[model samples]
Target: MQIYNEFELIARLTHGLTTRPDVALGVGDDCALLDIGSDSQLLATCDSQVEGVHFTLRTSTPEQIGRKALAVNLSDIAAMGGVPRFALISLVIPPRFSQEALEGIYRGLRQEAERHQVAIVGGNIAGAGQGKQLMLDITLLGTVRRGQAITRGGAQIGDVLCVTGSLGDSAAGLFTLLHPDGTGAENALTFVQARHRTPVPRVAEGRVLSAFGPAVVTAMLDISDGLSGDLQHLCERSGVGARVFAEHLPLTEEMQAIAARVGKDPLDWALHGGEDYELLFTLRPEKAREVIEAVQAQTGTRITRIGEIIPSGMCLIAPSGTEQPLQVRSWDHLH
Candidate 1:
C-alpha cells in the first residue's frame, strides 16, 4: 500500500466527515470554528510536540519544550483572529522522567498561559508504556466575534500578500543547534536559538487584522510549514495562485549572518524553513498600506508586502527580474 504525505493523508481521512450547521468551519483551517449560542464563535485547535521529533533536551530546556508545545497551538488560535480563553494539556510521560524537569515544564506552561491570559482549565495524563519519548498534546479554545474569524479561503485575485515579523530565524537557530561550531557571534547564536525555542505568537497582530474584517483582510494562516508551503495552502484554499517577490522577503540580520557563516543561501531558508510561527496573510491591494501601518503602529511588529495573489500558478519573481516556479519544500512530519 502507498503511504500518503501529511496533507494527502489528512484529506483522505477527513473526507465527508459528518458535521452540523454549528460547525461554521472545519477540517481545513487553522482552527475549528463553531457557532455556540453567543455573539461570538468558538475557535478550537490542537497541536502536539514529541521528544526527538519536535525537541531535544540537548537543544532546549524542559521549560522551553513546554512553552513551545503551547506556543505552537497559540499560533493556530492567532491565525483565526481569536482571543484564547482556555487550554487543556495532556501529557504522555515516559518512565522515570525526572520530577524536577516535569515541574519546570509546568512552570513554563503556566508562564505562557498567564502571558496570554488563558487559563489551564483541565487535562489528562497517561503513561507512554514502552515508548521512550515524552509528548505534550494541547487543546486550546478561543473566541472571536460572531462573524469575524479569518480564514485561508477568503483571498481573491490581486490581493496583497503580507507576512508579520522576520522569517527563517527559527530554522537558522535549529541549524546552529544541530551544527554548533561555537564560531558564530554570541549574540547571533543566542538570538536564533531563542527564536527556535520560544516563538512569539502574533495574537495582538491577529486581533488588529481581524478588526479590519474579512472583506479587507481577506485571508491568513501562521507560517509553521514554511512560507512557500503555507502560501500554497492559502492559494489552494482561496482557489487562486500567487507570485512571491524573492527580493522582498524579510530576513533578519542574525539569520543572514548565520547563513553567511554556514555558506548556505538565506533565501532558501526564508522560503522553505519551517516553524517561524509568523502570520502570513492577504489583504485588499488598496488597503495594504493602511493595514500595514495599523498593524505596525499597534503591535510593533514589522509587516512586509512580499507579493500579490494571482489568478493561477505559483511563481517566484527573482531579484534579476526573472520568473521561476515557487516550489514548496517545507517540513512534513509524516515524510
Candidate 2:
C-alpha cells in the first residue's frame, strides 16, 4: 500500500469542503488570509486534547475526540459572544495510528464546523516516535461586530452573576466513566457519558445576550475550567469580588442522583467541575430578570442568577447564610 504524505492528507480532507467568502485564502498556503471586513472584530483561540491527559481511546471514540477538541475552542468564541468562521487544526500522530481514525477525527470536526458555519481553512500534522502520546490542537477564528465583544473585565460590583444551563453534568459524566464502581442505572450512565463526550457550546445563548446592545452583558466567559476557577478569572480581571449562593446552583437531576449514589457533593461538581461549556456571565442588577426572561424565551436555555459581583474577594454563600472563601480547585497544568 502506498502511504500518503501531508499534502495528500490535506487534499483528501479539505477536498469538496465548503468555503466562506471572508476566507480569501485557505489550505495550501503558508498562512490563511481572512478578509474580516469593516464591521467585525476578529476572535482567535486555541485548545488542545491529549490521549492520556484529556481522554483515552478506551473511553472515547475518535469522532468524539475530534468533535470535543473543536467544541472547546468554539466555547471560547461563544464566551466572547462571537460567531465562529474558520479553524486551523493541528495533530501529533503516533506512528501506528490508522488513516481510518484520522478520517473519523475529520468527520467529527466537520460535524461541528457545519453546525457553527465555520470553515476548516488550514493546519499541520506530524508523526511522533515510539511511546509518544497522540495530541490534537485546534485554533479557531471568529468575529463580532466592532465595539461589541464582551470580556471578563467589564463586570460591575452590583452586577448579578448568572450561568446558562445546568452545571456539574460534565464532571459527573467524566467521573461515572472513570469510576464505574457503585454507579447505578445504565440509563444514568449513558446520560453522563454522553455529556462528557459531547458538550454543547452556548453559541446561540451568547449571541442573544450580546445582541441586546453593549450594556446587556456586563462580563462573560465560558466555563471550561470549572465555575469557581473561571469566576475568579472574571473577578480578578474586573478588580472585583463575588459571592455565589450555594443553594441556587443549577444541578441536573441526574447529576444530583449520581452524586448521592457516589457519596459526593453535587455542589463540588457544580463549583469545581470543569468542561461544562456553559456561559458564566454578569448583568446589571436591575436588568437581570429582564435579560433572563428574554434568554429563556428566545433560546429555551435555562439561566440562573446564582450570585452577585461584590467589591473585593470571592466567596460562596452557604444556605445557612455563612460566607466562605471560594478556592481555585479546578484543573491546573502544574501543582
Candidate 3:
C-alpha cells in the first residue's frame, strides 16, 4: 500500500460516499451542512487531538490541551458562518492517566464552552487498549439561518480575500516551545505561547460576516492548514484563483521579533504555518470595506485584505513587484 498525505487520503476516503438529501453540503467544506426540517440549517464538524501527534503534556498543560481540542472544532463552525450550540466530547484514555489532569482538562473545556455559550450535552469515554497516548475527539453542532451558510464554494472573480487577526503567532509560539533556547522579548514569547495553547476562534466575526450574507461575504474558512494551503482549498472549491500580496499579509511585531530571534523567516510562518484558527474569507470588491468595518466595529477583530480572487493560477506578489507561484507548504498530518 502506498502512503498518502492527509488531504490525498481524505479525498480518497470521501470519494463517492453516500449522503442523504438532508445533507445540504458535505465532504468538502469546513462543516457538513444539513437541513433537518428546521428553519435553520445545521452545521456539523468534528476534530480530534492525539497525544504526541497534536500535542504533548510536556509542552501544553492538560487544561490547554482540552481547550485547544475544542477550540479547533469551534473554528470550523465559525468558518461555516454558524453559531455553535452543542458539543460531544469523546475521550480515549491511556492506562495510568492522571485523574486530576482529566479534571483539569474538563475545567478548561467548561471554561471554553461557557465562553462560547455551547452546551456539552453528552460524550463517551473509552480505554485505549495498548495505547499510550490520550486523545480527545469532539463533534460540534451549530446552526445558521436557512440560505445563509458561508461556504468555500461561493467566491467570485475580483472578490477581495481577507483574514482575521495576525498570522504566524501560533507557529512562532510552537517554535519557542520546541527551541526554548531561542531568546526573544518576554512579552512576545508569552503572547505567542498563549496563542499556541489556546487559540481564539473567530466566532463573533463569523457571525458578523454571515449576517452580511454569502452574496456580500462571498466565501469563508478558518485557517488551520496555513494561509497558502487553506487558500488552495478555498480556490479549488470556488473554481477560482487568487493573488496574495506578500506585503499585505498581517503579521504581528511579536511574531516578527520571535522569528528574528529564532533565525527564521516570519513570512514563511505567516504564509505556511498552520493552526492559527483565524478566519480566511472573501468578499465582493465593492463591499469589502463595508464588511471589514462592520466586523471590526462589531467584533473588534481586525480584518485585512491580503489578496483578491483571480480567474486562474494562484500567485504571490512579492514586495519587490515580482510574481511567483504560491506554494503550499503546510502541515500534513499523514505525511
Candidate 4:
C-alpha cells in the first residue's frame, strides 16, 4: 500500500479551488500573499468545528459538517462587511476515515467557497492516529473598502439594535435532532435540522448594512454567540447598555412548536441558544426605518428592531412592561 504524505494530501484536497485576483500566491507556497489594494482593508478570522463537540457523525453527514465549519468563519468576515477572498484549511483526520469521506468534506467546503467567491489558498493535514475524532479548522481572509469595515464599538446610546433573520431556530433544531420525538411534525424537524446543520452566513446583508453612510450602521457583529450574549458584546465594545424587548424578538412558528413539545421556552432559545450566525447591528435612530426597508427590498432578509443601545449595562423588557437585568448565559466552551 502506498502511504500518502501531507503534501500529496494537500494537493488532492485543494484541487480546483480558485483564488481571487488579489491573491498573489495561493497553494504550494510557504505563505499566502494578498494584494488587497490601497483602497481596501484586509479582514482575517479563524474557526474550528470538532467531532462530538460541534457535531456527531451519527446525526450529521460529512458534507454538512464541512459546509458549517467554513460557514461559521464566513460569518465572521460578513460581520465586518468584508468580502471573503481566500481560505486556509486544516484537517485532523481520524483513523479508519476514508479518503472519499475527506474528499466529500472538501466538496462541501467548496460549495460554500464558490458561493462566496472564496478560494482555498492552502492548509495543513494530519492523521489523528487511532480512537480520535475528526476536526476542521479554517482561517479565512477577506477584504473591504477602506473606512467601510464595521466593528462592534460604534453604537450610539440611542441607536436601535436590529437583527437579521429569525433566531433560536438553530438551537431548537439541535434539540429536535437530539430529541426527535419532541418534534411532533416531520416538517418541523426537517426545517430545524437544516437550520442547525447548514446555517447561511449573512454576507450580502452585512455588506449592504455597511455600505450605508457611516451614521447608518453604527455597530455590528454576527450572532454566533446568541442574541442576548452577542448583544452584550456589542454593548461592551461600544461602552453602552441595551434593552431587548421580548415582544419584538423574531421567533419562527417552527421554533415555537419545537419548544412546546420539548417543554423549553422558545424565548430562551432565541436569547441564549447561540450559533445562529445572524447579523446583530445597531443603527441610527432616525434613519433606522429607511435602512431596514432598503435591506428588505434588496436582499429579502427579515430585519427586526429588537432593542436599543442605552447609557450602560443590559436589560430585558418583559411582555408585562417590566425590566430585568439580562443574564449572560450564553454558550461557553469551558462551561
Candidate 5:
C-alpha cells in the first residue's frame, strides 16, 4: 500500500495511544510534543525496511529482518553521538503470514533493544491485503547532553575520514547469498551473512567520540547506503568533498575472498557496495589517533583512517591515483 489509504487512520488513532505530559502537543498536531531540557538535546531518526527492496524472504529470517529494521535506525542515533532511549515501531504484514513469523520479528527487535538498553515506548501494527508486500518502519528517539550531538554538516577540509568497522562485508555477504559458489568458503560466508542480518551499530564509538571533545567532529554520517553514497551525504552536508585511498580501505578477508572468486572489484564493493551499517565520519587531524584508538578499544570495532576530507573539485581520489567526481550510485528506493 502507498500509505495514503490508511494515512487518516494513522493520524486519527495516534492521539489515543498515550498522552505524555512532557509532550507539549502530539499527534494530529502540527508537531510532536517535548519539554526540551536545558541541559539535554533530543534526537530522532527513522528507517524503513521492505521485503523485496531491503531484503528478500529467500535469504532472510523473520528475526534477521526484524533486527535489521531496528538496527539501521539505531545506527543513525549512534552516528549522532546520542544514546537511544525509546522506539516506535510500525509493522505492515500480509494476512497469510504465520503468527510465529510475526512474533519472531518482534523477538529480533526486542533482542536488539535489550542489547542496546532501549525501551519500546510505543508502536502501531496493521495488516496488508493479499499480494501486498511487507514493511517495517521504526522511529528511534534518543537523547544526548546539550552541545554533545554530532552532525553531518560539521566535517571540515583536512579532517581525517574514518570508518568504525571493515567495509564491503555486507555487500559481499549479499553476493554470497545470491551466488552460493562461495558456500564452501564456510567461515567467510557466515561472517558476511551475519553482517547482513545483524549489523553492529557503533554506539559506543559515538559515545567515546563525544567524550574526546566537540567540533573535533568536522562531519559525521552512518553508512547504510554504500560508502560512496554516504560520503556524498557527508560531503554535501558539509559542503566539502573527499578522497578515499582505495588501498587504505579496511577490507575483511572474507570480503576479499568473495570478491576474488566472483571477479568483483573488492574496492568497488568497498566503495559502493552498501548496507555495512558502519559509521563514516571525520575528525580534526590532531585528535584522529586518540579518538580512533579510544573508540576501537571501547567498541571493539576497528577504526580505520582511510582518507581525508578535501575541497569540492576532487570528490574522491582513488588509490590508483585516478580522480573522479563521486556519485551516489548506491541504494535509493525510487531508483
Candidate 6:
C-alpha cells in the first residue's frame, strides 16, 4: 500500500479539485474564499463525526450517521441565529460496509439537506484502509441578514436565562440505553435515542430571537455541550454571569425517575450532559414574554426561563436552598 502522508494528500487534492463560481478559490492557498451578497453575512460551521467515538457500527445505521453528521453542523448555524443555505460533506468510508450502506448514508444526507433546504455543493471523499475506522466531517455554510446574526457575547446583566424543552431527558435516556437494568428504560430510552440520533436544530427559534430585536435578546448559544458548560461559555463570551434556580429547572419526569434508578444526580446531568441540542439564550426582562411568544409562534419551539443573569458571576442555587459557587463542568473541551 502506498503510505502517503495525510497533509500531503490533503494539499494535493486541495490544489487539484474543480470549483464553482461562488467558490472564489476553492481549496488550497491559506484559506478558501467565497462570494456573498452585499447585504448578507456568511455563516460557517464544522462538525466531525467519528466511527466509534461518536457512534458505533452495531447501534447506528449509516443513514442515521450521515443525517446526524450534518444535523450537528446545522445546529451550530441555528445557534448563531443564521439560515443555512448550503453544505459540503467529507467522507472517509471503510471497505467493510457494503456499497448499499454507503448509498444509504448519502440518502440520509439528502433527506436532511432537503428538509433544511440546504444545497449539496460538493465535498471530498476518501477510502479508509481495512483497519481504519470510517469517519464523516461536515461543514455547513449559511447566511443571515447583515447585522442580524447573533453571537455568544451579547448577554447583559439582569437578562433572563432561558432554554428550550426539558433538560436531562437526553442524559437519562442515554442511561437507559446503556443500562437496560434501569427500571425506567422504557421511559427514558426513546428520548435519548432521539437526542443522540436526530437532534432537532432550533433554527426557527433563532430567527425569532433576531426578530425580537437584539436589545431584548442579547446572548445566544446552543447546548451541544452540557448546560453548565455551555452557560459558562455564554457568560464568558458576554462578560456576564448567571444564577440558576434548581427548582425552576424544567427537567422531565423521566429524568428524575431514571436518575434515582441509576444512582446518578439528575441535577448534574441536567447541568453537564452533552448532545441535548437545545438553545440557551439570555433575554431582557421586558422582552422575555414577547420573545418567548414570538419564537413559539414562529418555530413551535418552547422556551423556559431557568434562571437569570446576575452580577455575582455564575452561581447555581438548588431548590433546597443549597448555595454553591458554580464550578465549571468537565464536559467542555476548553477546560
Best by lDDT: 1
Candidate no. 6 TM-score: 0.85
Misplaced by over 4 Å in model 3 are: none
How would you encode candidate 6's per-residue C-alpha lDDT over 214-265 as one tens digit per residue?
6777878788778887887788768888999888877877678778877899
lDDT by residue (tens digit), candidate 3, 58-93: 889989988998999999999988999999999999
Clashes of 3: 0
What's the C-alpha lDDT at position 54 in model 3?
90
Expressed as tens digits, the lDDT of each residue in 1-335 for candidate 5 is 54432324555566468766665334421113245766766677677788888877789888888888889888887787778899999988887678898898899999999999999989898888665678899988887666767777778889999988899999888888888764437888899889988898878888788665557876677887789878877777678888877778999888898888878888888888898988888989998888887887777888898889888743556767987776656766555
lDDT tens per residue, model 2, 24-135? 4455321233567777767777778888889888788889888888999899888877888899999999988889988998999999899899999999998877756888
Q: After superposition, how far is residue 294 of candidate 4 from its true place, in Å?
A: 1.2
lDDT string, candidate 4, 214-250, tens digits: 5689988898878877887788778899989999999
Ranking by lDDT: 1, 3, 4, 2, 5, 6
The root-mean-square deviation over C-alpha atoms between each candidate and the true structure, in angstroms, is 0.8, 9.3, 0.8, 9.0, 6.0, 6.7
Superior candidate under lDDT, 1 versus 5: 1
For model 5, what is the C-alpha lDDT against the true structure? 0.79
Q: Give candidate 5's TM-score.
A: 0.87
Question: By summed lDDT, which 10 consecutive residues of candidate 1 come out lowest?
Answer: 175-184
Query: Candidate 1, residues 212-287: lDDT per residue as tens digits?
Result: 9999999999999999999999999999999999999999999999999999899999999999999999999999
lDDT of 2 at 172: 93
